[model samples]
Target: MRLPIPTLALIASILSVVTAKSSTGDRVLVVLESGIEKGDYSKFWKSLEARGYSLTFKSPKDDTAELIKYGERKYDHLIMYAPGQKTFSPALSPQSILHAQLDGLNTLYLLSPSLSPLNRDTFREYDLEFTDSSAGNTLISPFSSLASDPSSPLIFPAHSPLLSSSPANPVLSPSTLSGGPIVFPEAISHFAGETPYGFPILGAPRGSYVGGSGGNSNSTAGEGRKGGEVVLAGKMAGVVSAFQTRDNVRIGFVGSGKALSDKVWEASVEDQEGVTHRTANAAFAQDLTSWVFQETGVLRVECATHWSKTGGEVEKAEYRKNEEVAYSVSITQYSPSSGTYIPLVTPPSDLQLEFTMLDPFVRTPLILNSTASSAQGSTTYSASFRAPDRHGVFKFVVEYWRPGYTYLRSSTTTAVVPLRHDEHKRFITGAYPFYGATVSVSVAFVLFCGMWLGMGEERGRKKAE
Candidate 1:
C-alpha cells in the first residue's frame, strides 16, 4: 500500500532533523544573557547553522557550563552574546580559556560597557580591547540613514573594506540602503610575537559617537574609530576585528550586541526616492563568522626540506661554502567547499627563501618545484642557490606573511664549512698569476744555489794547486 502524504512528510522531517543533528563540523559553544529566549535569535543561529557549525547554547551561570574536558577542548569555537553576564563558569577563567585557544579554540565575542572583571581578563589575554563609551555605553551618530536624530542609534552606510588588507567588500544595491557602524573602536595588537594573531577587518564610518552620559569615562578609542571628538570618536576606527593563534585557531569580535540582533539584522530601508535595499549586516555576518571558524583565509605549512645541490638528497647538518643547495616547502589552506585544507599550488609572487647566518646571505624567490624536484604532484615551492663563499652555521629560512592570510614561518639550520684541504683546487684560474710567480721564484733559487756550489768547488781546487 502507498504511504499517505502526511506520513511521508512527517518521515522526511524526522530524517532532516536527524541529519542536522548528526552533522560533523566545528562544534560551537554559545553563552548568552538569560531571559532572552533562544528562539528569539533563531535567525542568527540559523545563519551559523548554514555554515556547517554545530551549536550548543548555555548561560554563563549554567551549573554545568564546561568548555574543556581532560586536557582536550570539548568545543572548537565560542560565541559570547552576553555582554552583561556577571560571571562565567570556572572552566572559562583566563588561564583555561587562553590554554584552550593555544590548543585551538576560535571565538566570536560582543561586549557591553558593564564589563565584568572575568570578561575583561579574557580579552586582555588575547591582546584585544573594547572601546569605552564616555557619553554612555550606547552610540548615537548624526550620520544616520535610519534615525533623523544624531543622538539616536545611528545607521552607517558600510562600504569599502576597513583596509586594503581586508577581504574585498561585498557589493550592495539600491545605493542608498547602507550599513550601520557597531559602536566602539576596538584595539587589536595585531603584530606578531604577542598572544595569537589579532587585527581589524571591518570599520565604521567617520563621525560616529558614543551616546548617553554620566558613567565611567576613562576609555580610549581604537584604530578606525574617528570623526566625533571628545574621546568617543576620533579620525579612523574599526568596528569589527579578528585574531588567530599559531594553531590556526581564530577569534572575531563585533562591538555592538545588536549587530546581529533580530531587530536590525534584517535591515530594509526606503528613501524619498522610494528605492529599497538590504543593509550589510547579513554579508558582514557571513564574512566574519566564516573567518572566525577558519572557513576563510586559512593557510598551513605542511613540511620543509633542504638538500645538497650535487645529488638533491637530504641528510643531517652537512653543507659546504660555495656549494649549490636547494630548499623546498609544501603549503595548503582551508577550502570551505571541499571541507579540507587543500594544497596551495600557485602562491603569490612575493613568496621567498632566506639563506641566513645572522643577516640574509641569499634572498630569492621560491618558484613552483618541478615534479622531479619535489614529491610527485605536491604543492611545493622550491628554490636553489649557491651557498655563500663564507662558512658558519646557516639556515633555510622561509617567512611568507601577507595580509588576509595566515603567516607562514619555517626555519631549518645546517652546518657549513670551508672546503677541506684535499678538496681545495690544485690550481685556481683567478689565482694563476700568483701561482706562476711563486713557481718562477722557486726555480730561480734552485739554479742560483747550484751555480754558487760550482764556483766554491773551483775556487778550492785553484787554492790547493
Candidate 2:
C-alpha cells in the first residue's frame, strides 16, 4: 500500500538532511562579532559549500569558544570576520590559536573598523599585531583585468600560481571585478620580522604609505617621532595579507571589513551593476577559503644528488682532464595522503648540471629516464660527457623551480688535473715524425764514431811498426 502524504513528506525531509550532512564532510567554523554585516560572505560561502565544505557559525560568547580540544583540531578552517571588542573569549586565547595552528587548522582573519582590540598586546604571542595606524597603503593587481567598461568597479589582481594551485584556487573570472580603483582610509602593514615560513600574498610597492591626518597614538615606532610620521609604513601595505606556517596552516588578514561588504560587492558606477566584477570578489573569497580548508597542493623536493656511474656512488674528489664521466640525480616528492614520500616523475626539465672551473665548461640539461625505475618510485636523469679539456676546479649544479614547488639546488665540486709525467703516452700519432728524425740522427752518430775509432787504432799500429 502507498504511504500517506504526511509520511512521504517526512521521508523526503529525512533524505534531504542525510544528503546535506553527507555533502559537508569537513567543517568550516566562522567566528563573527556580535553585530557585523556577514551577508557579504554569503555568496562566497555558498560557493564553498557547493565545493563540499560544511560551515559552522559562532561568536566569542559561545560556550565552547576554544578551537582546539584535547590537542586535536576542532575545525578544519577558522574564519574571523569583523570581530569587535572581546571578540575572542578568554578561552580562545593566543595559546588556543597557537595550538590550532600546530594542529594544522587553517585560519582567515577578516579585518574591519574595530580590529584594533584583537591586535592588543595579549594576542602578540600568536605572531599577529594590529595597529590603529594607517600609514601602510598599497594596491595589488590581479593576474588579469575584470572590468567590462573602461571605468567600472575595480577588483584586486592575483596572478601568482601559488594562489591558484591546489588548495588555493585564485578565482580568475570573479577577480575581474576588482580592476577598478579601490580607495582605503587605512591599510594593514605586515612587518619585516615575521616567521621564516610566513609568506606575504599581497603587498604594496616598497616605500609607499597611506597619508592620513590622524596618527595612531597607540602605535610604537622603532626609532622615530610619535605615530603620524609613518604609523604603518615599510614592507607590509595591503588591504589583505596572508601567512603560512611550516605545517602548512594558512592565516589571512584583511585590514578592512568594508572590503568585503555587500555594498562594496554590489556597488556599480553609473548605476550599472557590474556582475562580472562582482564575480572576482566572490572568487577571491572562495579561493582563500579553499586554501585554508586544505584543498590546495603543496610540492617539495626531498632529495637531489649527482654522481658519476663508475664507482656506483656520488663522484669522489677528482677526475682526470677529458675523462668521460656519467652523471645522475635522484629526487622524491611528498604526498600528504600517503604520509610517506614518493619518487616523482618528470622532475622539472629546467634542472641544469654544469661542469665549471670558473666559467662553465659543459652546461647541459638533464633528461629524466622514463625507462628506469627504483624502489623510491623516482626517475633518474643520466648523461655521459667528457670532462672539459682545461680544468682546475669543476662543479655540477641543478636549480629547479616550478609554479608551486619549493626550489631545488644541487652542486658537487671536483678537481680536474692535467696528465702526470709517467701518465703521458711514450709515443703519439702527432709526434711520430719527430721520433723518426731523432732515431735517424742517433744511428748516424753511432756509425761515425765507430769508423773514427777504427781509423785511429789503425794509424797507431802503423806508427808502432
Off by over 4 Å in 1: 1-25, 148-162, 166-196, 211-229, 271-275, 312-317, 368-379, 431-465
Q: Kindly give the stretch of ten consecutive residues in candidate 1 with the minimal lDDT sum.
A: 184-193
User: Which lDDT tens digits does candidate 1 get at residues 1-465?
Assistant: 999999999887655433332112479988887745677667888877865577988887775656778877888888877666666677765566677777877778865555565665567666755444444444444454343333323334344343444333211222322443332222211111234366655444455544333333333433223322334452334455666666556777666655576655656544224445455566566666766776666677788988887865865476888888888788776666555666663456568999999999999999876573345334688898998988899888998655456678899999889888899888789999998999999999999999999999999999998
Scored by CA lDDT, what does every candidate get?
A: 0.62, 0.54
Give the TM-score (vs. native) of candidate 2: 0.52
Every model's TM-score: 0.73, 0.52
Candidate 2: where is the Cα deviation over 4 Å? 1-25, 117-130, 134-155, 158-189, 192-195, 204-211, 215-230, 233-236, 266-279, 300-465
RMSD of each: 8.2, 10.6
Residue 140 accuracy (lDDT) in model 1: 40
